[model samples]
Target: MSDLPLRSQLAVALGRTAAKMSRLAGKGDGSVIGGRIGLRLDPELLTRLAKDRKLVLVSATNGKTTTTRLITSAMTPLGEVATNAFGANMPTGHVSALASAPSAQYGVLECDEKYVPQVLRETGASLVALMNLSRDQMDRAAEIWQLAGKWRRALAESPGTHVIANCDDPLVTWGASTASGVIWVAAGQHWREDSWCCPECGGPLDRQEGEENSDWACRQCHFRRPTPQWALHGDHVVDPHGRQIPLGGIQLPGRANRSNAAIALAVVAQFGVPPEQALPLLAQVKSVAGRYTTVEHQGRTLRLLLSKNPAGWLEAFDVLQPAPGPVALAVNAQGPDGRDTSWLWDVDYRILRGRPVFVSGERRIDLAARLEAADVQFTVVDDFEQAVMSVPPGHLDVIANYTAFQDIRTRYGRVV
Candidate 1:
């Protein structure tokens, strides 16, 4: 920060002042607006603050926030590290995190898929973790292939960055393949719709589906999944040539998180944090921006979870299966959650089969219709609070998308 021009320092001070006022006013976390104001004044504030810091950038269509949080924790033993706390993945969030903690020696951040290459370049990040790529925010975001192309070009330019990528997802594999040095992790990917065609050639690719050891190949263009040095086996990630390493301390359920843990461990291992040391850091993470956390609200305690797209929903549904009904699925179509709710049709609602589900949110009717088509029994309690209270209770899994999830956290989880 001492290297930054005086005007840049003033801009950051103004932004920090705005952030403090925002918190005082109970508006929300000041990361977004504060960073926006700062960037408007000093366009290069993001890159300026990133200089000389040990940086790690995490990006994915899903699981990025959780994976980034896990990676940040694994890097903690290294000392003071700045991280994005609100799951803000865009440039603004990165600016806020770096500017707010100018003295920090390291920064770990989750970057939006399309913005990953730019963030990597601006931060001159030493390590990048690429998880899986799938359809998300379909109304506004570029196609998955286009994002992959951007990553490929960006990595080609940033020859100094080492990549930690998922080997199971073809798009991620292709994107990370050209990095200077890459550590492959066989982190599992469940959604396959976007990756059926070869990224190299527009022909169909071959896929062998499995929980942890899935394989994919593109015979037309000779593109294939890299053999991973770290692979997921059942509940834990293992090195086939080495000993079994348990995916411990991670409180989040679902194999998806286990896969996330495997990728995080791989990234930190390059920094000299072995599985024994790194795994525990990740295990302490119970939630990423309230994905799997319980909070007392109204008369009952509501266990909260959030999923944005079909791929995310599938994993959240699988994790909450043992939870007692009636399940509260609050969904909305505000800008942050994507305006189009058509993706609701893509989610496997059949998993909610026998359980009683209560739909709430601005787009509750849209979700109800999708559930009806699948013959999943559900009741709509128009009031989100009433819906959560209506759950039959041994425990309840209350899942929401972006905006609605934040609303729940603000109204119910915190200040209730």
Candidate 2:
């Protein structure tokens, strides 16, 4: 077991070396070594996690990385926290991250939906935060219900663990029913449009109907949205004890982010950090790269929105108010991000609203076809540079899928 750590260290070093070689060889996918290392070291890494270590696992289709980052960042003021920041949410990624920090006081890690069961079982985390379950990477993740089932079983076994859940998502609410203690955080009515229907009943879900804000409930059945044990009212997130954490000028936008911000506050609150101390640090935290990140090209500003799935694309569209200039969107058929381009249909393309959109990527044609079918106007470009060049100067909106996001970031020299 001692040698296992050394072997894992050697493997991680070799993986880094291989990644460098791949980049030098001009065959950089940026995921080659991480992928290989994840597949190989996962089993050995899981076996090595000591039961004494206190683990905090965060999972969801969207916002896992961002929420994990926020929670980890907020927790740092309290004590040592080990985390996987690079979207490595699977078993191997958890192992690699854990292996990297052998003696962390707390393991604050993000976990992928499909890998949550394995991570929970092996890592033995004291706290598990499930942000929300949405349709993402459908080809790999299957239905939302299937993922929920796995989580349900996993949570049943770990009855002692604390669970942080988004009450708006039915899948997460159902999955977290068995949790020992759940800290719920919900977005107000402004962002609740997409969640009106129950995923379970195909019937209208009852929402707290006051205004057009994001408040939620089940209409047809009695499965109503739970009033958050911890709730966010604009910039203030209130815990169950009525303690208020004033979040001023968060780095991310929209009500979706409010939900994430609330969860982050709740997670940090669980670690006993006073709301006053942690609330001040949130304004300093920045959005994860490619997720609403803005870049300057020549004299114009291009905002990058990483839309990896239908729910993500819809939410991105929801958050965006109509911009004055033309919008640029990119979609790709790459692995990990999925080669199947059909998931775009699930997005509310009608929201485009006759905006002049420039589409490009490996699946540019597919995007164009979908736009055409929806009667939305768009011009297609195969070259990303040409596509960016096509956008007129001054405040451009750009939305791109996974590979395209990396491509644009690389082109702009923003990749880490």
lDDT of each: 0.85, 0.72
Question: Using Cα atoms with residue i matched to residue i, what is each candidate's TM-score against the true structure?
Answer: 0.96, 0.87
lDDT at 191, model 2:
32
144-210: candidate 1 lDDT, tens digit per residue: 9999999999999999999999988989998998899988998888788778899989888888865
In model 2, the runs with Cα more than 4 Å from the true position are: 1-42, 188-204, 208-222, 319-321
Q: Considering summed lDDT, which 10 consecutive residues are worst modelled in model 2?
A: 187-196
Residue 267, candidate 2: Cα error in Å is 0.7
Please identify model 1 stretches exceeding 4 Å from their true place: none
Q: Best by lDDT, which number?
A: 1
lDDT of 1 at 212: 55
Per-residue C-alpha lDDT of model 2 across residues 112-198, encoded as one tens digit per residue: 788878778776778888877766776766687778878888889987788888776777887887777777776443333345567
Q: How far off is residue 404 in model 1, in Å?
A: 1.1
